[model samples]
Target: MGTYDYIVVGAGSAGAVVAGRLSEDPGTTVLLVEAGGKGRDLNVKIPAAFAKQFKTGLDWEYYTEPEPHLDGRRIYHPRGKMLGGCSAQNAMIYIRGNRADYDAWAAGGATGWGYDDLLPLFKRAERNSRGGDALHGGEGPLFIEDPRSPHEVSERLVDAMVEIGLPRNPDFNGPTQEGAGLYQLTQRRGQRWTTSDGYLRPARKRANLTVLTGALVTRVVLEGDRAVGVELEQGGSRVVHRAGREVVLSAGAFGTPHLLMLSGIGPADHLREHGVGVVVDNPNVGAHLMDHPMYLLNAETTAARTLAEAESPRELVAYLTRRRGLLTSNVGEAGGFFHTTDGLAGPDMQFLAGPAYFWDHGFATHDKPAIAVGCSLVGPRSRGRVRLAGSDPSTKPSVRFDYFAEPADMTAMVTAVERARELLATSAMRGLVGSELHPGAAHTTRAELEAQIRAGVEHTYHPSCTARIGSESDGVVDPTLRVHGVQGLRVADASVFPTITRGNTHAPSVVVGEKAADLLRSGVVAGGRAGQVA
Candidate 1:
């Protein structure tokens, strides 16, 4: 295969930005490889139809190896496999996590990754419909807009949270995050806008950029301690593509670690068992996994026409003709960050409420029109692990989030349930809501609520930190995102987050790409940028 200045694996959220930004220099050549096809499905464009892509070709459709804490249930983990990755598959919520998250990373030995350091990158990647501010960007690729049509019940949900003792905040991304408001979305005119749209699409026309779809990277081709290129199985043949400067792995939390271990960059004993040569004996390759375990509280709604009728003829007509209707709803429509207890640096929980019966990844539905309020344990102390099931790159890795493994994790979730119940009973929700559908009247006590949470909990789909940024003693990637024992290689996705962000991971992943581009460019020391590759 041909050689390029940079080879970016997995054209997902961060990968798309990495490839697009690197190719900005016309003198540089970049190749972006994606395992899935271009994400152009009609459902991908419709914000409300995001759940329709789950388990489809666009989804990786992964399942965990049975969590021991949650009655041994094998929780489903759906990841985007196509161009924009989860950005094309997510609810389009445009949230950058708490400022404390980045500051913690710098404190934890991830130098130069502080909130002040990355704020510019976040602003640089944005094009808010509300225009520029001290905190937002007005002229960038990513488009963030208010909901085209907000359902009355969704608005009431925000009011309900405020009535239940939270402050009313018009802008969650403004000075503070501890308040209730309708969320802005990553959309333009009611259509989903992904990093693929913001970054990749415009850059694809560049002569120096080459994008290959349906290409699954098997492993890194290492020349001693340096990653020279990547071996990918595209079509029916396995080919090697050389990276003249560097090989950046934006293959996500799971895929990046999987590819690293397959390339003999993991624990020496584990590699020996798989009959593979060991180049680096790092044990932190697939450890320290963390995710926000979420629970949805649904209630029958006699006051609002929920998303059950979103596909009806009238709604369809409105969406088709004007792009303004229930079809434009991003299901978790109105929400805000909150704390389960006081004096925390930031909120430990988030409320994502909407006028819909969202459950079991939207596969399970209710007979009556209803509203759903989802609470995620954003600040969990629990960690998990990801290990290869076999030596084969085609096999999915074995994962277990070990959710609720820490007693505090369960306590916070229970507190979240109590708060959700408070929101449901508030005067703002009195006429709009009915009987509780999940963890109903029977589960009221602390223990009962804990049981209900264990039985009914889901997640916010924010999995991260498997290849976290740390010293060689604790993590796979260093502060600069370079692998500990490898040269000319780096990991630039949620995998490199020192700790999971307290909110959606999409926007931060894009920032990771922007920061990676700067770091790669800054590597020009004594020679030309490409010629300086180790």
Candidate 2:
């Protein structure tokens, strides 16, 4: 057995930040344990090759056990099992969600998590290509850059939005998120930059930090109510390590909750059902599951100007030599947020445009001249749950995405799809596009669109809120993200978000980690004393 000041579970998106930050103080020792191997795959480094890494050894390809609400189909959830975790495999879109998302957290029991409080941390963690300011920070670890190549389709998409009266926003993470524009990716000089590359890589040189890859944690070793350490299976051998200070759970939305339940820190009846003695009876360990359900509208380009036409030897050469062309596009090249109606107070819909038919984001190869326009409803009113299947640590948790359970959610998605079709019908988009591939012009009725949406909508890859923060009687975590019934344990990921954000959740997840790191390093203190140097 070994000991360290901090034993961070899961070296994924958030864990990387915690391990990296805690190790910054040379006096403290940090141990980062990852179930997967080092994420050095070529696909991980290349900005556009992200799809190639899915379902591979580097991925923990989790699937929901046939969600009954969505035609009883199992949804594919490809989480990264590599060093950077999903940040290494994700589409690289950088979105911090709306300022209201944080403010809502403050209103809903998460004190010190308001927009004004978290903005500085967001700025501090980003090294945006656009440079530093009150809005964008440049000296931080994570790199955000413009795509190496911009497509004409993006221009057409933005033009259509402008025609519809939506402003063209140059930066979505800027002052407001109510416009259409090109998406800035998590890249550095045209290369994919993950949390591992940005945060952990630089911090690895610190003598106090020890990163252990291929170490699968089976349980959090608890001594009474305190999480003292972790038990991991490394090299086919079980080893235990004690934390001198704390065991930080930054294993992300899925992994952390699973680890918690496995270690007997979940619903009492469920733990008893699995024959595992309860440690904390935290009934909300995996409740309130949520995800962004998206409908993709495929259309053939009128002029073969899409990525489909550019995926040839010539384009490959251009990419290899100059880091230019379709290879650098994050697929979801340009998008925007807009209100469905004038009466709405905030944007309720988001469009994710791509110049290619990304059959499961290209997880499966196809030979269709397709480009996808994703229409998603922000702030879905529907909720779902994640539950343990059995007592075994290796068993995958059963996820019920319960998509479109609410009428408003379905209505919003249908309207968003109709809006996307209208945007495509505009003069600018008409000149750039061909015919609709999925729901053709014949399918125009609201019922038909709803059916099509129900049939075609899939996950937008943002699963969160399984371990939400709320008041004493309503939530699993408190204002500081600490588990309600458990001591010396906290969950810092999308799972802790009270409500799903209005955009891609990667940026917000990172922000949660940054904030959690501050809390952990400061002995898990809330506000006022937060952001102070150790």
Top TM-score model: 1
How many backbone clashes does every candidate have? 0, 1
Q: How do all models score by TM-score?
A: 0.98, 0.96
Which regions of candidate 2 deviate over 4 angstroms? 309-311, 341-345, 363-368, 524-534
Model 1 bad stretches (over 4 Å): 524-534
As a whole number from 0 to 100, the lDDT of residue 513 in candidate 1 is 95
Backbone clash pairs for candidate 2 read: 357-370
lDDT, candidate 1, 343-457, per-residue tens:
7889999999999998899999789998899999888899998888889889998888999999999999999899999999998888888888998978889999999888989
lDDT of 2 by residue, 494-517 (tens): 888888898988898888889888
lDDT of each: 0.90, 0.82
Clashing pairs for model 1 are none
Model 2: ten consecutive residues of lowest lDDT = 525-534
